[model samples]
Target: MIKVAFFDAKSYDEVSFNKTNADYGFDIRYYQEHLNLKTVPLAKGADVVCIFVNAECNAAVIDELIKNGVKLIALRCAGFNNVDLKAAKGRIKVVRVPAYSPHAVAEYAVSLMLALNRKIFRAVNRTREGNFALKGLMGFDMYGKTAGIVGMGRIAKELIKILHGFGMKVLAYDLYPDMEFAKQYDVQMVSLDELYAESDIISLHCPLTPETTFLINAQSIAKMKPGVMIINTGRGKLINTEELIEGLRTKRVGSAGLDVYEEEKNYFYEDRSDKIIDDDVLARLLMMPNVVLTSHQAFFTVEAMHNIALTTLESIKEFGEGKPLTNEVVEQ
Candidate 1:
């Protein structure tokens, strides 16, 4: 049996994998501790080390894994930005579930947009307290508004379809433009500046690359239409949190929906309600009524979780059998 040291093991993860692993029958050990330098020793004799977005798979950690006889690094989440692929090269194999469900994330982005625009969170709180005054519950119609999408990936494509259904003119920007898909969907492929100036709402779905980090900084926000709504369900560092707060302060950004933060790895998955947030930027963001911060749960749907478990386990099984790993993450 292939031993898998599953790190950052949440109860939901265990539930999903345990049910799916019945068919694969791999020896699985679950640990709530994240995969880091200190926790890497737990995988001393394991054949595979399972990790999530929060796992610290830096070069040093990779070296430790190699010393411990670990051969494979299995990432359960879609984003591998946290992992050092350059360091993992030519050493241990790395594989990820390229996509579990695009709809789940896209739908959550839409929900954020709706909640912010309609002041749904505020209204719910007021009504629950029996203060049902409509003084600040005004919302504009989504119809006839222009929505700009940062990346035309799977989640962006799904979001575009939904936005178009609501009579929103979609403007998309991608490093690589899929002209065929754009033409089919009647989406206008525009330059970043054009999208920023023309869009009433801008949503990010891009990957976190060196070039894309802090993509939404002060300079970019300055080019956007005044009071433009920004929604980010993508990687946290995609937007500079300090700059976003400044934009909100000056009314440059009307509202923002954030499911991830740049420093989210510290406090996103873990419960810190009892303890005050030590990060000043994150705490300031929390104080903003315009901002709706979620705990990186855009991909929490049951269907998505099931697919993630099945796909991750299947990749491990293939690695064990020496089969071609279609989902393997090789150095590009």
Candidate 2:
């Protein structure tokens, strides 16, 4: 039987993973704490180790895993930024659920955009206190508006379909152009500069890489249309939080709907409301009336979770059976 050690297995995580692996014929061990160099011994005879986002898979952790006879690293989420790819280049194989449910993330991005644009969060809070005045609840219609989408991936393409249904024009920018999909969806591929300058609402769905880190900075914001609404359901650090705050303060950015933040690992996936928020940037972001932030829940839907678990377990099974992993990540 193949032995699998799942690190960072919270209550929900175990429930979902077990539900999917009921008949997979694998001996699975769950650990509540995150996997690291010190905890690498937990994987002592296991063939595979499963991890999630926020877990530190640095060089030290990778070295320890290799010493413990671990062969594969299966990531339940799409982003593998936490892993040290350099260390795992030739030693162990790394696999991830690259595309789970694009609709879940795309819908959440749209929900954030709608909530921020219509001031829904503020309005709900006021009404709960029995203040039903419409003094500051003004919002624009989505019809005929132009939306800019960064990185035309699966989620971005799904968002384009929804935006098109709402009578909004879609402008997209991607490193590799999919001209066939663009023509089918009636989306116009444009330069990044044009996308920033002409879009009323800008959404980010790109991955996190060295080139994409802090892609939206002070200079980029300066090039954007005044009062442009920004939405990010992609990886955090894509937008420079300090510069974003400056944009919000100056009203250069009319509003923002963010599902991720640069310093989210400290606060997200846990409740910090009982204590004072230690991060000033996160605190300031919360104080903005036009800003709406969620705890990286763009891919938290039931369907996405199930798909992620199934795909991850299937990859583990394939590795154990000496079959080639269909979702393997290789270094160039």
Candidate 3:
């Protein structure tokens, strides 16, 4: 029987993973702790090791996994920045779920945008306390506003649809432009500069790579229109937290909504309410009423979770059967 070890297995993860693996004929071992060099030994005889975004699969961790006879590393999420491809070069195969319910994440981004613009979180809190005055609750209509989307991928396309439904003009930028989709959605394919200067709201949907790291830095922020709202549902490093804090302090950025943070690995997926926050930038962000931060749960819908578990288990099964992986991430 194939042995598969899963790291960072939360309650929700176990529920979906088990449901999908029930008939896969694999013996699964789960650990609540993240996978690292110290925990690599636990995968001793396992053929495959599954990990999530928080697990440390660095060079040292990868080396130890290879030493422990781990053949495959299955990532439940799309982003694989946490994994060191150089270390796993020819030793272990890496695979990820490329697309898992884009609508789930897109809708969440729109929800954040709407909540921030409408001051729903603050209004709900005030209403709960029997204070019904709309003293500071002022919001602009989304209709007729220009929305700039940084990526034209699946998630971005879904966001475009929702924004179009709100009667907002859509401006999109992507390395590879989809002319057909742009025409269909009445989205204008514009340059990054135009998108920044013209958009009333800018949302990031790109991945984190060498070219995309800190894509929304001080330089980019300066190009944006004053009082422009920003939303990021993509990777945390895509926006520089320091620059964002500076913008918020100066009021260069009107309001921001984020589901991810640049240095979220230390704070996300864990409870820190009992302890003082060590990250000063994050602490400052939380103090801003205009900023809304979530625990990187934009893709937390049931459909997305089910797809992730099914795809993850299928990747392991494919590797076990000596077949080429459908979602393989190989170095060129």
Clashes of 3: 0
- Candidate 2 lDDT over 1-332, as tens digits, reads 88999988878888888899996968899987688877889999989999988788999999999989999999999889999989999899999999999999999999998998888988999999999999989999999999999999999999999999999999999999789999998899999999999999999988899999999999999999999999999988999999999999999999999999998978788867789998999999998888998899999988998999999999998898889989998765
Model 1: per-residue Cα lDDT over 1-332, one tens digit each: 99999999999999999999999999999998999999999999999999999899999999999999999999998889888999999888999988899999999999999999999999999999999899989989999999999999999999998998999999999989899989888899999999999999999999998999999999999999999999999999999999999999999999999999998888978888899788999989989999999999999999999999999999999999999887998877
Task: Give the poorly placed runs of model 3, Cα more than 4 Å off.
Answer: none
Ranking by lDDT: 1, 3, 2
TM-score of each: 0.99, 0.97, 0.98
> Candidate 3, 213: how far from true, in Å?
0.5
Q: What lDDT tens digits, residue by residue, belong to model 3 across residues 158-259?
A: 999999999999999999989999999999999999999999999999888999999999999999999889999999999999998888878889999999
Selected candidate, larger lDDT, 2 vs 3: 3
lDDT of 3 at 30: 89
TM-score of 1: 0.99
lDDT of 3: 0.92
lDDT of each: 0.94, 0.92, 0.92
